[model samples]
Target: MEFHWCKRAQRQQGVAIVEFTLALPLLLLTLLAFGELGRMLYQYNSLLQGSRDAARFVASRAWNATLGKVEVSPDLECMTKYVAVYGAPSTPPCSLTGMPANTTVQVTKLAGTNDHVQVTVSYVFSPLIASGLPAFVGNSVALNFPLVATTVMRAL
Candidate 1:
């Protein structure tokens, strides 16, 4: 009876080892997914800050230089630096270094008013890990992610 019990214990130990090996990959994947999510969130917030900065710049510029008013001017070069500009959402994400072709900065004076200017910054959001992950997993269809930031400020 004692010998029989020892054999049973040995079998259980082997089973535990096998189970652990099978589960290790899954555990690691979960951890990576969480880390990717955190990174994406941080990027998204940065984009928002970029938009705000662009808007402020537009409002602070010399309106007399562009529209002959006391309002801010819309300068693409300056705005590009403030935000992540992309040509196609995923094709290229925001870059602190340069603005992508898909990235667009539109500055317009309020239709009914002469002093208000609108600054709109649009870019695509790229997932932290999309290549290895299966398709149809994210809220976005693994395509161009729309990240837009807009602000309206009176010309400074």
Candidate 2:
């Protein structure tokens, strides 16, 4: 009985390693997917906050009490874009780390009974794993997606 049990234990010694090797890729992929999701959420939150801040900046500065409407100028638009992208009104737009090159910011002043300023920031999110995922339906779709954040506030 002892001899038979020893033989069985020797045969099963490599089973755990083989199972782990088979599951490792899936486990790593799941972890990477989760991490990518978290990073995307964080970037979206940052973009939203930046839009809000830029909108507030424009609202406070672009208001024209005499005209009864928001005055949006070329310089103001440029500054607003800088604020949304770099968190400040930079003379020469500085590069923000982790911010995509295709990021765009638009500032608009709505004319109505109560004038309001709108700031929109759009960014393209590119996942770390750009390709290699199998698509069962048809063609493999690009993983890149857009993240847009908009904020509107009454001009002060």
**28 in model 2: Cα distance from truth in Å?**
1.0
Q: Which lDDT tens digits does candidate 2 get at residues 100-134?
A: 47798889976464579899999989888764456
User: What do the candidate models score in CA lDDT, each in turn?
Assistant: 0.61, 0.86
Residue 68, model 2, lDDT: 74
Task: Give me the overall lDDT of model 1.
Answer: 0.61
The TM-scores, one per candidate, come to: 0.64, 0.85
Tens digits of lDDT, candidate 1, 16-95? 78899999999998998788779767766766676666666656653565556754322443443443343222222333
